[model samples]
Target: MNLELLESFGQNYPEEADGTLDCISMALTCTFNSWSRDGHKLVSASTDNIVSQWDVLSGDCDQRFRFPSPILKVQYHPRDQNKVLVCPMKSAPVMLTLSDSKHVVLP
Candidate 1:
């Protein structure tokens, strides 16, 4: 796959943006979850054991949540603002609840 890193605002392309993440083995698909009002953060997952929360405004990964198995899909809850659903390829789905004070892991 061809990789190109654009500017923070995605309005222009940088000339020297060729860094790749070595942790990702295979990226099947990715989607943006619009949970925040400012639209700054996005959750992305791959066939690897990593789930990443990226900052679109800064073009950097803010936080990463790792899984025991390879992640098949990731999605944000529609009604709940602090919940994310993660599905693995071989196991049952997991619910990750993110709040201001604590992080809850549910099976």
Candidate 2:
């Protein structure tokens, strides 16, 4: 599938110099981890220890979650949409709730 850029937002923080906010002395630090569900919504985890939920059609971030460590991978539950699994680079996968953005490590 082909995708086009619509809008851009700063990762981790809204007022950061991510080229979208501060264009004078910019720093493009946010990188994509390639995690998507169909073509409607996607989850992007950056090196800033942040996971962002995106709306494919509108190119808007619907929600944001801050993890304890930098997120390595993100996956949605097979049977549950509200529950997501986020794996940090130095640790195991943790359960994340989409409603409140609460994350709990699985034992």
Candidate 3:
């Protein structure tokens, strides 16, 4: 695994920096689902049981949603740009509708 350490300036710097910590233990998994209609937002999830909408251009976490169990997988809807499917390890998968109001329970 090629682990790159980011600098304080949030840029990729040399590995042999003056004071760089070599070890990190944060349990997180992330993947991009799809781009928003406005081309500004991206949907991503982590093992920490959190789903977040990120800004692709600015590289910022814009919105977050917490699940009851650790998120196992996440994917975007093919036809509708605003919908996503989230699968948790312990529970049934859920379909989240993008207007941020409706959720469909799936088996």
Candidate 4:
């Protein structure tokens, strides 16, 4: 997979970044979910009850969150860079604060 970073983005991303995102080693296995507001990070959610954050430049997973249920989607908060909203298959949506690893279920 080639990830093309638009020139307008003004990042040092190579014109043609090759290979699947390291966040999800096997792209076919997990959902390539969300990117951070700054485009510096990636989040992947999988049926294996895992959520992972990866560094875009290094392609290294920086953090991992595990839940009891499979996650359908993971979205980064629009304004809070350290927070993410997670939607699970069989439970209420959750708000995760990366700074402190707090898990709060949304009402």
Tell me the number of clashing residue pairs for each predicted model. Answer: 0, 0, 0, 0
1 versus 4: better TM-score goes to: 4
lDDT of 3: 0.76
- Which ranges of candidate 4 are over 4 A from the true structure? 1-28
Best by lDDT: 4
Cα-based TM-score, every candidate: 0.55, 0.62, 0.62, 0.70
Task: Candidate 4: give its CA RMSD in angstroms.
Answer: 13.5
Give the runs in model 3 whose Cα sits over 4 Å from its true position: 1-40
* Candidate numbers sorted by lDDT from highest down: 4, 3, 2, 1
Ranking of all candidate structures by their TM-score, best first: 4, 3, 2, 1
How many Å off is the CA of 64 in candidate 3? Answer: 1.2
The per-model lDDT (C-alpha) reads: 0.67, 0.74, 0.76, 0.86
Better of 3 and 4 by lDDT: 4
**Model 1 worst lDDT window (10 residues):** 29-38
Q: Which is the winner by TM-score between candidate 2 and candidate 4?
A: 4
Return whichever of 1 and 2 wins on lDDT: 2
Where does the lowest 10-residue lDDT sum fall in candidate 3? 1-10
Q: Which pairs clash in the backbone of model 3?
A: none
Best by TM-score: 4
